[model samples]
Target chain A: MAADKVFKNRIRRKLIQIAAFGFTNCHAGNFITGKLYNGKFKEFCTPGLNCYSCPAATVSCPIGSLLAVTGRADLKVSFYVWGFLLAIGAVLGRAVCGFLCPFGLIQDLLGAIPVHKFRLPKILTYVKYAVLALMVIIIPTVLILATGRTAPLYCKYICPAGMLEGAIPLLLTHESLRDSASVLFWVKLAILLAVIAGSVFVRRFFCKIGCPLGAIYGLLNKVSLYHLTVDRDKCIDCGKCAGCCPMDVDPVKAPRSAECIRCGACKAVCPKGAITIGFGSGRKAAKREGLVDMNVYSRK
Target chain B: MNKRKVIGIVILIAGIALIAAGVFRGELDVILRKAAVVCMECIGLG
Candidate 1:
């Protein structure tokens, strides 16, 4: 029975990895021809942080799309983009971060490399929200509204995912793109290298501290349909669930913590089978049981 | 049938409808034009 369960878990991880790669790089022609794919699919945004500039990307990154709209002088708020983000957040929350994001997958793989792992300070988790507010929303919006100038501050200056997936590939394939590279390119490259190095020591370092998209989705995790649920009756408070959590979320105390990426690592590790990934009224039940603190609920 | 579920469903439907309306109204043209290029600025070329 244990062997069967292990086999099932392996299969599930493999399937999710395959889905993540396929969804992000579905534009086969772009990869073959070494060009960007401009199609109707490009009109839509993917649930994860796949860069639109990626050669094989058929869809847009929601953060990139939001930044693009925010940088426009004529548009104040993109109802479509905001609505899309809210909808995705309300439904899936950070499950998209866990199972869908190509960059998240890369971080996971890098984290899997044999090394001494360290836990990040819980305070560091709040940085992504600041990135969301400053880099993604506030900076671009203020620039467009105040100066009538558009700048995707996050993508141009901050997004390591865009650097790794889009810039690196384009630089390799198109010499014209290489000519355009400047100091900013080196800065982005340095940031990507730092993020990659951090991933080796800390699981999901970028997702935990830097991804504005993850931060946005994390906000909706409390109200999202899909989330982790803990059964207080079955939980022994063994601390195993908290130990296994890559994102540093304590499932027993806050099953639907904003920091939770819904990787199911806790669920897999729970000896009591108290933690579950499901859609239901588990949030309220946890609240009623006093397992969750109302202050933390609202503060996060 | 919880309050959270009800609110989530409503938001989900509204979001889908909004995106659909935007697409029908040709908001996608903006995205199409942007995606067609390599976005040199985005990749830190500028």
Candidate 2:
């Protein structure tokens, strides 16, 4: 199958933009290294829903921070966490996974390499919901009650993001951390390795089948302020939108499907220009041909 | 191969290895203690 020309280039442009941001912000003085994104000058955290814990993180991980504040017995006002999640979700939704998440970006680059892809069974997809319910919420609450201390348990134990963005960097930068590898660290490392390797065989099997955050953000595909709209009038029912969906959404029946990540692949591939992205009152529906000159690059 | 099945098997094996590591040290309780913390802390369910 030929790769979609416009999607490929759009993806590359997004990656380059992220890489350039990373490059410009690599300076520790500018990046704000530590728990507070405020101790000195404020720097842009990767603008995704990643956790803020995991020691090597220069910018705060939002989900981790959110859970931390939420799980806290203290009940302090988590203004940063609330504001950050709201602002990002309101503006971009899960487009963060497609365009901005450093870890998601890494997985996509790995997937872009030629490999035998696997079609995961649908039953496994529920695992992410279980993770969200059990790990993210229930477990943390239980632990806090038991120990009177809270931690981002999922990020600490299960997130490959912690391994990539936290553990590896800390290990590389600190010799003491190398000697301090507990069995738990090895377990997380092994999982990280599997996730990285698995991306080659499964298109975001982690995000599709195991990511609690994806499960949460994906729901916004329908009602999020920014969203995808499908024109039933223009849709030829070719199933191209569903075919193009990386998260396996049936764009025909539920164009705002929970699994839709708003990656806009459906928009790029719609033969009849049936799908579109819209915001606020300017959301007048249009046929595909209406957006003929609307280059995909500029929209993002 | 199912990733969860693979993870389950790995966890089982690791649990066994940890038991052995404890038995050799003549401190079975230590293994349980270590694993208990991890199980509670790592599984995200505490």
- State the DockQ of every prediction: 0.63, 0.02
CAPRI grade, predicted model 2: incorrect
Cα lDDT tens digits, model 1, A1-300, are 434544576468658966877877787666556699887888888888888899989788887777776666666556678788889999999988988888888898899899999898888989999999988888777788889887778999989988988999888888777888888899999999999999999999999999998998898897789988777766788998788788888888898799998877776676655565767545454466454553443211
Please write out the lDDT profile of model 2 over residues A166-230, one tens digit for every residue: 56654555565566677878788889889888888887668877777676666444445556776
iRMS for all predictions?
1.5, 19.5
How high is the lDDT of residue A182 in model 1?
86
Candidate 1 residue-wise lDDT at A145: 83
**What proportion of the true contacts does each candidate reproduce?**
0.68, 0.02
What is the Cα-based TM-score of model 1?
0.90
- For candidate 1, the per-residue lDDT at A212 reads 91
lDDT of 2 by residue, B1-46 (tens): 4342344344435544543443343332221222212122332223
User: Which runs in model 2 stand beyond 4 Å of their true positions?
Assistant: A1-25, A28-46, A49-58, A76-83, A280-300, B1-46
